[model samples]
Target: MTVIGFLKKTVAVPVALAMTLGMAQADTIRIALAETPSDEMAAFFVALERAKANGLDYEWTAFSDEELAIQAVLSGQMDIGFGTPYAAMQKSKAPLRIIFQLSKLKFFPVTSKKYETLADLDGEPILLHSRGGGTDSIANVIEEKVGMKFGERSYVPGSSNRVVALVAGQAEATILDLSNTNKIMEQHPDMFNVLEMFEVEASDEALFANLDWIQANEEDVQIFVDALYTTWRDMNADPTIISKETNPDGPIGQLPPEILGSLDDFYTAAVKGGLYDPEGGGMKAAQADMEWYSEAGQLEGDPASLNIDDFWYMAPLEAAKAK
Candidate 1:
């Protein structure tokens, strides 16, 4: 071949390569979280760090609540989100897919010393996270199991808020997760008592993404999922990693000095309380959630017939498990 022709071909090849690289660099994956920083998002933050190390570019947005997070994923405003709203699945018009289950928020009924059990709260007002959130669902199950009913109640919107309500004598009882429950009990040792710890099999947080986005960015999606599963494994393997990585000026760090200092203890207590899995894999938890939510009337179809395989893609998780 002529030298001139060869040079031209070499230059053309480099230009094409540059264009490809530019396109890949320009692509950004957006993830939505329900809050700025919380135990529910620990794995995700760790995963984001890992993903950056793996050459993946992502942006994160925090919504006020799970409903909004799900809406963001469904509307294509975000590529992925944390939280599982079974009701949204049965009710939303958008096509949202549950890519992975994060973890379960084990709830306990916390009450002042005056009350002891579910039945004790009959005709008494209680505080809940919201009208139709995880806490409300647990309340419903508790009522069913105890064959009683909750009386007049108010929505406090957050675990910390509910804890304050209970301590201030604003409400008789409230259901809360291990983290917040631990914080309250530790901060004021004598103010509250756990009435009972109720094990509700459900996914507190799940990786959700737009179906169309996944189909279009299959490779990126797979990589993101793989990093997330690996992060979960690593976080669970060493719970201290969360406290270490926590930014002193970041969300969790911005808590009052007292709360910030006790973060590590809170995480330790959470691990022991079964708030997280040592292995961090979610297949078993997902299956259990499928059954539990179905039984709780949150899911529209029977758990056995729900085609569990359709809800989650196990390839990434399986790969992480193998590692």
Candidate 2:
């Protein structure tokens, strides 16, 4: 072959191989959300941008519920699943590991214009979030802590519906999250009473993947976890980052003006209320989560029997923490 042909053969072959390798190395993680975008979900989307900057690319699919999301992750259909199903995980023997705790259950108990405290709730028909959900969990804790039992419990899903019941004088009391809680307080500032409630020091959501998937993609998992750690830390420091990073045309921004207007206040309240845990991943969180779920009747058996390492893998988060 001529010198020109030889150069072409060597250069072109190596360049093509390099392109293939680059394509193979471009780590793109697929994540599944348990539900549609809410304030916290939108905050995570903001963190996706941060994750990209750290060499991890992502594609996401939102499941209608946590069960489906967990199934998807378990089947290897998604790289990560949100809203850790601790109870389901143990029951089904899913080989999943929690690498990050997203947020805690930030709920508020709202009532009619009359009730003042947990004592006032005694012997009165009360509305609960669901038969067995975060709201009921809180209600159970309240009953035990204050030694009072509500007269009748009604299952009403959706904070808005429960809020409507409270406003319409249909239901006496119920629990709500930050957004709906704020919405209620804003619209009819004096009509209802948002009773002071205790903060559940338990995990509401988590980042988890199949154990095999995590073991195989350790670097990508670390990048994803680190990005989230940074996002939570930064958001904790400055709640405004959410508003700044939120796409004005995105889902959160497109929410009704009332909600959009109160976004800043909602986040400010969340940050101050300890919504996000600074230690995104740890054994302490894992243990606390197990205890809470056990008492709530969601998880069974001894909390001590459950191994934190089996459920929570903290290496990625420890690496991400900017200490």
Candidate 3:
């Protein structure tokens, strides 16, 4: 997929300041991420820089995983979180509302030369990310769709860790994100092969916030949303903007030089894969997310029964796109 091709086809903030709400603190919007810092989030940080330029005060913290991130947001320790804990939010009746769909699930099940197909791994052990992560969710769907189930499950949070484990003979099979998959195949041309998997119209990340906070900070939220949408459009139009805004002292630059070499290739694949949504503010993406999660058994009952109003708040996103 050419970068320009995606650009040709696709057409696609902050308030938390000076508030005397129930919690007493500074005005920055407290944001939380489900995972530690990595290159995937570089462009988001660039958007935050843009938001700062617009005088939106914000700060973010990273949780060990999405589960914790959701908890933080529900407890109001953070104003917003970067993950989709749909089931948990529904069960708890948490006032969380998804404001942005960050990225689609563009994962691949990859393994060493020993396994050539998904059916070949019926009794083999597989290494994956956390139980509810993107790779893990894809594996769940693969099992149902292909009528095959692996033998054992091992959890290793990062794709790079799983890749290292596969190479070190600690595991025979694992699921990886696109960039990691590319890096593995590039390094050991004959060692690993990606198993064919069906496309999952699922979201890997989203921006969600407590309903009350969003209502109170509408204008600021719109500013942040608009900044993020602009970031996606800008980055898609020129992949080099990612590298341009990458702070040398920041997370992306701190990655090993070898991983940095694959940065351009990674974004190239992302654009081709349609990982970033062109219009992220509507029910279209949310509907797909619901269906995918329901199919994966991550949510209970029929997806059609899940009301969009319960899970999403699209006004800010819609307003952002209008700008």
* Predicted candidate 3 versus true structure: per-residue lDDT over 134-207, tens digit per residue: 66677778888889887888888677888899889888799988778887898888888898888766788899
Total clashes in model 3, counting residue pairs 3 or more apart in sequence or in different chains: 4
Q: Estimate the lDDT of model 3.
A: 0.75
Stretch of 10 with least lDDT, candidate 2: 2-11
What would the TM-score be for candidate 2 when compared with the true structure?
A: 0.77
lDDT of 2 by residue, 2-69 (tens): 11111101111221122122121135676766655666565686677666676675655555556666
Cα RMSD to the true fold for all candidates: 10.7, 10.8, 8.0
TM-score of 3: 0.88
Pull out the clashing pairs in model 3.
13-223, 13-224, 14-220, 15-220
Q: Name the lDDT value of residue 228 in candidate 3.
A: 89
Best by TM-score: 3
Q: Is candidate 1 or candidate 3 better by lDDT?
A: 3
CA error at residue 161 for candidate 3, angstroms: 2.0
* Clash totals, every prediction: 0, 0, 4
- Per-prediction TM-score: 0.81, 0.77, 0.88
